[model samples]
Target: MKKYNLYCIVLFLFIGAQAKAQYLQDYTGRPYYLKTNDGVQGNPLLTETWYTATVDFANGKTANAILNYNLRGDELLFKNPKDSAVLAFVEPVKSFSIKGIRLEESDQADITFASGFPAVDDQTNKTFYQVVGDGKIKLLRYYKKKVLESTEFSSQIVSRTLVTSNSYYLFANNQMVKIKPSQKTVLAAMNDKADKMQEYLKANKVDFKSDVALAKLFGYYNSL
Candidate 1:
C-alpha cells in the first residue's frame, strides 16, 4: 500500500509538470513590429507606458509578463526577460489584463473612440475587444481599425492616419447584442427591466450621451 501511494503521487506530479510544459511550449518569439517611419499623428495604443499583464493562452496556460498592445496592428508584444528580447506573442491568447487601464468607448458624430481593450477571442482574425464589465450580463467593446490617407498642402506629402471605431456589446443568454450609446438603445438592451430602468434613468437624470454614464447604467442593471 505504501508503494502504491508513492506511485500515485509521482504520477500526479508528472501530470502537473506536463501541463505547465505544454503551456510554455505554445509561446514563440516573433518580430515585435515592422519598422515604420510615417509621420502620422494618431496611434492605437492608449499610452506609451508598458504595463504588467497576465496573459491566458488558448492552451489553458497563463503567463505573467510586461506587455504592450498595438491597437492599430492588433498585435500583442511581450518582453521576455530570459533573452531580453521584445517579441510578439504569437500564440492564441484567450485573454489578458493590463494594470491601470480600463476599456472605455465614446461616440462622436460619425466616429467612435475605444481604448484599453485587447482582443480576447477570435485570435486568428486579429479582432480586439475588452471586457468592460461582467456578471449575469457581460459588456464588451469591439475595436475596428481603419487607415486614413491625407496629402500635405505644401509638400504634397502623403500621410496615413490610424482611426478606430468602437462598438459596445451586451452578452446575455449566450447571445451577443450590439448596443448604441443612447438611452433608447441601452434601455432596449436591458429589455428585461426596460421600464424600470427607464424610470431610474429619468429619476437620476442620467445622460445617455456620456459613455461613463451609459456604462454605469449597465453596471447597475447587471447588479439587479
Candidate 2:
C-alpha cells in the first residue's frame, strides 16, 4: 500500500511538472511545429527546439523560424526531424559572408568559380553551409517541397560578383575571405602606387608607413 502511494505521488509530480514546463510553441502558442520525422522528397522534417530562431532578412521577409536558424546575415541553418511526414519549424539564415571561397586567376576569362562551404542541415549540426540548389550562394533547406531557409542576394550585389561564373560567390561573414581577384588586383595596384610615392616621400617623407595619407592609400587599395 505504501509503495502504491509513493508511485502515485511521483506520477502526480511528473504530470504537474509537464503542465508547467514550456514546450516549443509557434506564434499561435500551439506546439504545431513539433512534427517529428514527417518530410517529403527525402528531405528531413524539422523537429525540436534550440533548432530554430527568428531572423530578419534584408528583403523584409521574416521567418518565425520553425526549422531555420540564421547563423548570420549570409548563412542559415535548419534542423529536420527524424522520420515523420510532419516537418518541424523552418529557419532562415544570411550566410553570404566571404569566408569559404578561394580565388584563382583565369587568363582567358575575367572571373573564376569555386565551391564553397556546403550548407548542411543546421539542425543536424553538420557542415557549415550545405548546397541545395545550383548556385553556391543557394543554401535553402527545404521541407515538404517548401523552402525552409533561403539565402537572398539583391541584384546589385550579384552584379558586382557575377561577372564570371557561379563558382565564385559573395560572402559577408567578416572573415576577410577574398572572393574577387579583380578587387585584390585593384588593391595591389594601389599599394604599388603607394610604394612608388616613396620618391615624393624622400623629399617629404611623411612616414608613409604610419601617416594618414599612407594609411588612406592602403585602405583605398584594400577596398579594390
Candidate 3:
C-alpha cells in the first residue's frame, strides 16, 4: 500500500509539472506576416493587414506579438528599458517573452507577457498578465501594489478599459479629490517625469541601483 501511495504521489507530481510546462521564456511559432506602412499605429496596422505572431516570455508571463518577419530567419528583440543588463535575444525566434500559454477548445491559444514594466525598489509586485478569451490577453497594471489599469482583449479584439482609481487615490484621501487629469495629461506628465528620472539617474550614476528612485519621481510627476 505504501508503494502504491508513493506511485500515486509521483504521478501527481508529474502531472503538475506538465501543466506548468506550457510556460517558456522564449517561443517559436509559425509566422503570419501582414504588410504595413512605415509608422502606422497598431489598430490601423491590424485593420490594414494581418501581422505575424510569435510567442513571448517576459514579466513571468507568456504572450504573443505581431512578428515583423518569418519565424525561421527573423530575430527577436527583448528590451526591458529598465534593465540594460537583462540581455536581449537576437535569434530566430518564434516567440519572445512568453509566460503562460493556454489552448481553447477550438485550438487557439492565448499568450500573455509584459514589457516596459515599472515598479518600486523591492520589486515585490508589479503589473502582470491575465488571460482573457481565446487568444486574448491583458495587462493588470498596479499602483502601490494595487491593480490600476486593466488592458484586456478578447480573441484579439479590444474588450474594455478599466481605471480602478483616480489620481486622488494616490494621495490617501488626505488631499482634495480634484478632478484627475485626462489620460493625455497623465501620460504627458509620466513621460516628462520619466525623462527627468532618466536624467537624474544618469546624473547620479544610479540608473540600475534601485527602482525606488524612479518610483519617487513618478509619484511627484503624478502630483503635478
Candidate 4:
C-alpha cells in the first residue's frame, strides 16, 4: 500500500509539471518583422528593450518569454526565450503579466493586463488594459501611441514621431467607469468614500497626471 501511494504522488507531480509546460510551438504567428519607416524618430513599442513575461494564450496554454508591447500595433510581441527572433501570437491572448515592465520610472511593480472590459470608444473587449492596484475595485489604464508625420515642402522629406497617451477606467461592481485622474473624477467613480479620498489627497498631494500617482490613488481607495 505504501508503494502504491508513492507512485500516486509521483504521478500527481508529473501531471502538475506538464500543466505548466511552455508550449511555445503553439504560438500562431510568423516571425515578426518591425514595420520601420525611414526617418522615424522613436520606437513603436512601449519599451524598446524587452522584459521577461508570462503570457496566457486563448487555448489554455501559457509560456514564459522575453517580450515587449507594440503600442502602434496594439498587440503584445514576444520572442522565444531560447532564441532572439521576435514573434506575435496572432490568436488573442487571454491575459499576461510582465515583470518590471517600467510603465513609469517611479512605478517598479510587476504589471498585469486583462481583456473583456466593455467596449468604449475604439477599444473592444479584447483590448488589453493595464490593471492598477488590487482588491475587488480596479483602476484600468489603456496606453496608446500615435504617429505624427511632418514634411518639408522644399525637400519633401517626411519624418514620423511616436507619442503616447493614457486613458483611465474604474472597474467596480461589473462596470467600467471612464475617468480622469483628477480628484473629482476619481472621487465620483469611487463615490462610496469621496470625503475620505478628498481629505487624503489634501494631505498627501497625489499627482493626478502621473501613472504611479493614479495607481497609488486607487490603492488607497481599495484599502478604504
Candidate 5:
C-alpha cells in the first residue's frame, strides 16, 4: 500500500510536469517526451509508475529521486526534485537501486542494476543489466525492448507498442556468457563445477523458470 502511494505521488509529479510542456524534453536526452495520450499504444518504461531510487552516476555522484527505466530507449530517467520536470542523465548511470519488490518472491527487496561489462551481442558497457546474482560469478538479466507496430482491421491508424524480451547472462573471470534459465544451460556455463552444481541442485529444488531460483543457484555457485 505504501509503495502504491509512492507511485501515485510520483505519477502526480510527472503528470503536472507534462501540463507545462515547457519542462518535458525530447532529443536532449534519450527519452522521447512522454505523453499521457500520445496515441501510442503502450508504455515505454519497465514500470509505468515511478520508483524511489538512488542513482549512481558515472562521475561518482549519487541522487535520490522518483525514476523509471525507459526500456524502449534503454535509458534511466528521473523526475526533477524542484519543478517535477522529467529529466535524464547527461551521462549514463554506473548503477542504481529502486526500493520495492522486483521479483514477487524477493519479499520486497530493493532491486539494483549496473553496467560496465564488456560489449557482446549488441550490448555495450553502458547498457544496464539487472543485478540478479552477484559476487565472483554474477547473474544478470538484460531486458531487450523493441517497438512494434500494429493496426486494427478497417482502421487506417497504426499503433506503436513497446515490448521487451529478456536474456540472461553469467559473468565471471572477466568473461560474460549468455544463458537460459535452464539447468542444462546453467551447467554448461559453469561446467568447471558441474559436480558441485549437481549436488546443490539436488539439495535445493530449483525451478529454473523462476528468476529468483536462478539467482539463488548462481549465489550458491558463486559461494563455492
Candidate 6:
C-alpha cells in the first residue's frame, strides 16, 4: 500500500508540471508580418529602444521577456532569449509594462492606464490608454492608426498617399475621455481648475498640442 501511494504522488506531481508547461505553450503567439506604408508619421513603437516587460493575460497568467509594440498594427511582440523568434501576443493581454510605460486593455479592445484621478464611476470597460502623467490628476494619450488615401497631382502624374492619425485622451472623474489636443478642450475637461490651469499654462508657456508639453502641465498641476 505504501508503494502504491508513493507512485500516486509522483504521478500527481508529473501531471501538475505538464499542466503548467501546457499553459505556457498555449499562450505563445504565432509570428506574422506587419503591413507597411510610406506616410506613417512616427515609429510605431512608443520608444525606439526595446525594454524588458511583464505581460499579464486575461487568465491571470503572466510572462516576462523583452517586448515592443507596433501602434500601427496594435501588435505586442516579444522575444524571450538571445536566439528566439519574435512573436506577437495574439491572446488577450490584460496589461503589460515596457521600460516605464504601463498599458492596460480596455473593454473596447483598447489599452488604457490609470490617470491618477479619482474614480467616479463603476464602468468596467478596459480601454487602452497611454498614461502620460500620474498625480492628483492624470494625463492620458490614446493612439490610433487609420489608413488614409490621398491623391497627389504632378506634371501629368498622379500618386496616392497613405498616412496614420494619432489621437489623444484624458482620464478624469474615473473615466477615460477622448479630446482634441487643444487648450480649450483640455481646460474644459478640467473645468474645476480651468482658470488656474490656464494661468499656469501661460506662465509656463506650455503647448497643449504637444504630448511633452501636456505631460509637463499635468505634472505641474499635481505639484500644486
Candidate 6 per-residue lDDT, tens place, 1-224, comes to 99999999999999999887956764577775655566444456544666776667777777776777665665667764646666777766777755554333221222233222333232233434566666665666555454554445555544443344445556665666666767777677667787788798778886665556777777777777
Between prediction 1 and prediction 4, the one with superior lDDT is: 4
1-224 in candidate 5: lDDT tens per residue?
99999999999999888755532322124333765475566677777678888877776666666788877677778776566677776655799898764642332266788999999898888888888888888888888667679888999988887667778888988888997768788888778889999999889999877766777888888888
Task: Using lDDT as the measure, name the better of candidate 2 and candidate 4.
Answer: 4
In angstroms, the error of model 3 at 97 is 22
Better of 4 and 5 by lDDT: 4
* Ranking of all candidate structures by their TM-score, best first: 4, 5, 1, 6, 2, 3
lDDT of each: 0.65, 0.31, 0.32, 0.77, 0.76, 0.61
Candidate 2 Cα misplacement greater than 4 A, ranges: 1-79, 84-91, 96-224
> What is the Cα-based TM-score of model 6?
0.55
Question: How many clashes (backbone N, Cα, C below 3 Å) per candidate?
Answer: 1, 42, 21, 0, 0, 10
Worst 10 residues of 6 by lDDT: 106-115
TM-score per candidate, chains pooled: 0.66, 0.20, 0.18, 0.77, 0.75, 0.55
lDDT score, residue 112, model 1?
A: 21
Compared with the true structure, what per-residue lDDT tens digits does model 3 show for residues 57-108? 4434444444321112122333232332222243233233222232211111
Best by lDDT: 4
Q: Write one digit per residue (lDDT tens) for candidate 4, span 119-188.
A: 8888888888888755668888888888788887888888788888778888788887787667777777
| Candidate 6 steric clashes | 10
lDDT of 2 by residue, 150-170 (tens): 335753322111111122222
Counting only residues 3 or more apart in sequence or on different chains, how many pairs clash (N, Cα, C under 3 Å) in candidate 3? 21
Worst 10 residues of 1 by lDDT: 107-116
Write down the TM-score for model 4.
0.77
Model 1, C-alpha of 171: deviation from truth (Å)? 3.6
lDDT of 3 at 160: 32
